[model samples]
Target: MSEWLQLPFVQNALLGGLLAGILCGIMGTYVVANRIAYLAGGIAHAAYGGVGLALFFGLSPLLGVLGFTLAGALIMGWLYLRERHRADTAIGVLWAFGMAVGVLFTDLTPGYNVDLMSYLFGSILAISRGSLAAMAALIVAIGLFVICFYRDLAAVSYDDEFARARGIPVTALQLLLIVSVALSVVVLIRVVGLILVIALLTIAPYMAEKRCRSLASMMVMSSLLNCLFAVVGLGLSIRFNVTSGPAIICVASLAYFAFMGWLALRRRA
Candidate 1:
């Protein structure tokens, strides 16, 4: 294990996982607080269109996904804001549409044999230094955004009506949150894939929410929990020769269930 950690690819994978964990931890707090998991999922799945776009255009897949997901996020954000009650139906439609677009473009990319599973399930061990740098930049951007607007974000997350009454721009903040989630989803696609990205984003934050008293504390604890899950999952994957993305999510899911079970037993007792 120690020797394996020294390998450049392994090191990149570890760093990538940690960066992804932190990014997810912060944005995920708002995601769970805002009850926008479905919205995030839509953005994530929609990102596949970007993958196919990149492939078809012979551009970097990450760049393609980044641009495509942001566009999808804006569209979904508007739909959500415009029709809050019926947003789910629209989001679901866009979600499938985005995926279908990806598949169509991928097929149209003549003579290109794309590894579809990598985008859908992740390819963490194959992550490069460039991807790591991109992930780090996103973390810095998101960190600054959170620091500057923590109070307003907290107000909006918990109660938009009160936030609006207090003169906070609830609608704008909600849109920004959606955009941030899209960025986070783009970075995490390599860590946990589009399908499992929501699990990594929501599970740790969801667990932390139950134990923390404040949004700030929840973010802090959630980051730590996500980091732990990433590290443990990566280690287990290496040890058992399993797929890293699924391994990480499995660990997180187990922890979530275990924590809930403990709470249930305590309540009964």
Candidate 2:
């Protein structure tokens, strides 16, 4: 591991994994608490539009993805407030539309020979210093924001009506949660890609929640699980020459299912 850290790309990948793990843990807790996994996945796939636009404009793909997904998140959050029952319908529509538009834009862009695979499966080796810096900043900002409003968020996450009864501005907090979720999705796109991003966001937290009592404990356990999976997966990828993103996610899935199986056995016994 020490020798691995000596390589610049390895260092970048490690940093990227750390940031991605933090984002996943924090945002994922909100997702679980709010039952918004499908919604978050919709936002992630919708970010493909931003990626395609970035290719067309010769700009940073991450920025474009962030903007597009943030817009989609806001729209979904607003719709959920007015029509909770139809929110899933709205997400499905945007998810398909965004991906379709992205494909069209990528096809139309001249001399744009970008491989869609990296974006789909992630390429942490492609993580640059600038992107890493931006990711770090976003992670810090997200951490700070969550810390400042954790109580309100926890209340709203557990019971929106109760939060409202307590004058917690549940609506605004929900919006903020979704927005943060969208941003976290963007940050994770680099490490897990758009395709498996949802899994990375959900799996560790899901498993951690099983062993943890509070959201804070879940975050800590999730982060530790994420880091372990990331590092071990990256090492395995290096040895096997496989894709890191899917490798990490696969490990997470194994851990998640294994825990579930154990829980089931315990219940039966």
Candidate 3:
């Protein structure tokens, strides 16, 4: 492990994994609490449109994706709040558009040289300094927002009607949460990609929810669990020469099954 740590690519992979775990762990609590797990993948897939746009225009993919994701979040959030029935249709539309635009742009680009495998699966070891910096900043921002709005979010999460009656800006807060999911997807895509992001976001939170008594504790434990998966997955990938993202997801899945088995034993006892 020490020798591997000395390698620059390994170091970047570890750091990238850490950031992904932390960001997903925190925001994932909100996603699970609200029963909006499905929203994450949609927003993530839609961000591919941004990536495509950026690639087409020779701009930074991160910046382009961020802009596109924010737009998708707003549209989804508003649809969800105003007409829950209509949101799925819009999500479907955005999902298709995102993928279509990405493919179209990539095709049109002359000598379009990009790593689709890395985007689709993951490329943690290839993380650049700028990506790391952006991820850290976004994670910090998310942590602060979650901390500041703990009480309000608690109300909204557990009882939306009660929160609304208490004069909480449910619409605004919901939009903010959805946007945060977008930011999380951006960070997580490097570790797991849009295709597998929901697993990374939800698996830890689900396990954490089983033992935690409050939302706050769930976030903390989920973050820890995510960190565990990231580290273990990186180790497994290194040892076996496997893909990092899927390796992590497999670890998370194993842990989930283990937790479920323990619960069953306890119930039988």
lDDT by residue for model 1 (111-198), tens: 9877778878798999888789988999999999999999999999998999999999999999999999998888878666986678
Estimated TM-score per prediction?
A: 0.96, 0.94, 0.93
Q: How does model 3 fare in lDDT?
A: 0.83
Question: Relative to the true structure, how large is the alpha-carbon lDDT of every model?
Answer: 0.90, 0.83, 0.83
Q: Give the alpha carbon lDDT tens digit for every residue of 25-139 in model 3.
A: 8888988888777677678888777877888999887788788888887787777778766678777888788878877887777898666666677788778887788889988
Q: Model 2, poorest ten-residue lDDT window?
A: 188-197
Off by over 4 Å in 2: 57-59
Pairwise TM-score winner, candidates 2 and 3: 2
Over 4 Å off in model 1, which ranges? none
C-alpha RMSD of each candidate structure in angstroms = 1.3, 1.6, 1.7
lDDT of 1 at 148: 95
**Backbone clash tally for model 3?**
0
The numbered model that scores best in lDDT is 1
Worst 10 residues of 1 by lDDT: 188-197
Q: RMSD of model 1, in Å?
A: 1.3
Better of 2 and 3 by lDDT: 3
lDDT of model 2 at residue 46?
88
